[model samples]
Target: MDSSEYILNAHNKEEFPPAHTAEHLLNQLMFRMFGAERSRNAHIERKKSKMTFTLDHKPDRKEEKAIETEMNRLIEEDLPVTSEMVDRDHIPDGVSLEKLPEGASEMIQLVRIGDYDVCPCIGRHVRSTAQIGRFELLGTNWDEHAKSFRVRFKVIP
Candidate 1:
């Protein structure tokens, strides 16, 4: 979750706040479920978004549906989202630094979705998970050669 996405939110661009926040939560959910890291590639947008993760094998339909169910359950929990600034060196373990873009500040702002997720990000997010709406996994694709699976999702208000 250590990435420039959060900081990029401050720029007041066109990215949707709720969707962006949900992306963070979804990313963390992937990590929790599969012990996999965040998406190696992502394209988060208002209407729909996609995230690609490296997995030993692709998940079955049951697993994919489970992901959607769990994600929506978390959103309905209405957990609070908070942010705090911490020194770069003080970043907690399990947070990856690979996505931090160039020219990032020494102080990183971490966006926390309750106790579920705490990652350095600069994107705009909803104050609570309830604002994230229902998470729907629209589709999935697998690449055997790369051992990668991509999940496309959207939020239903």
Candidate 2:
């Protein structure tokens, strides 16, 4: 379909498209590696971003390095980022509505990063992964009590 057929919701925040797009990649990577759900909390900024995921165990240094490696690999793949508007009732398989904000509209925008990842989102994003620059994992913190793993990172352009 044409771009005119797709409607995007009014975004509350003006995110740095590159960083925001990187967040999607990170979320998908976390899921694929640890079977963890997408981050429940996230702060995406131009210079730095953080995402918190619930996991059964903390990822060691090697695993952390692998996350960075895989993210860069995907970025280097230069996948196209596209989106479509879909009815809530007809949401595609593997797409979850659990992360949708409260009072969201019935028409949802599904953002797809090539064949690597797809999710319902209304945030700004780069047209392709090549625009994301380099993925850097600055640090991480694991809260044993909460089972929360918070990752701090940024992209170097």
Task: Tell me how many clashing residue pairs each candidate has.
Answer: 6, 0
* lDDT, candidate 2, 1-157, per-residue tens: 3435665556689999999999999999999999999998999999889999999999999999999999999999999999888888889899999977788787888899999999998878999999999999999999999999999999986
lDDT of 1 by residue, 81-133 (tens): 98887777999997776788777777788889999998887778899999988
The lDDT leader among the candidates is 2
> Model 1, residue 123: displacement in angstroms?
0.7
lDDT value, residue 116 of candidate 2 = 96
lDDT score at residue 99, model 1, on the 0-100 scale? 82
TM-score of every model versus the real structure: 0.89, 0.94
**Best candidate (score: TM-score):** 2
Query: What lDDT score belongs to each candidate, Candidate 1 first?
Result: 0.85, 0.92
> In model 1, what lDDT does residue 39 have?
85
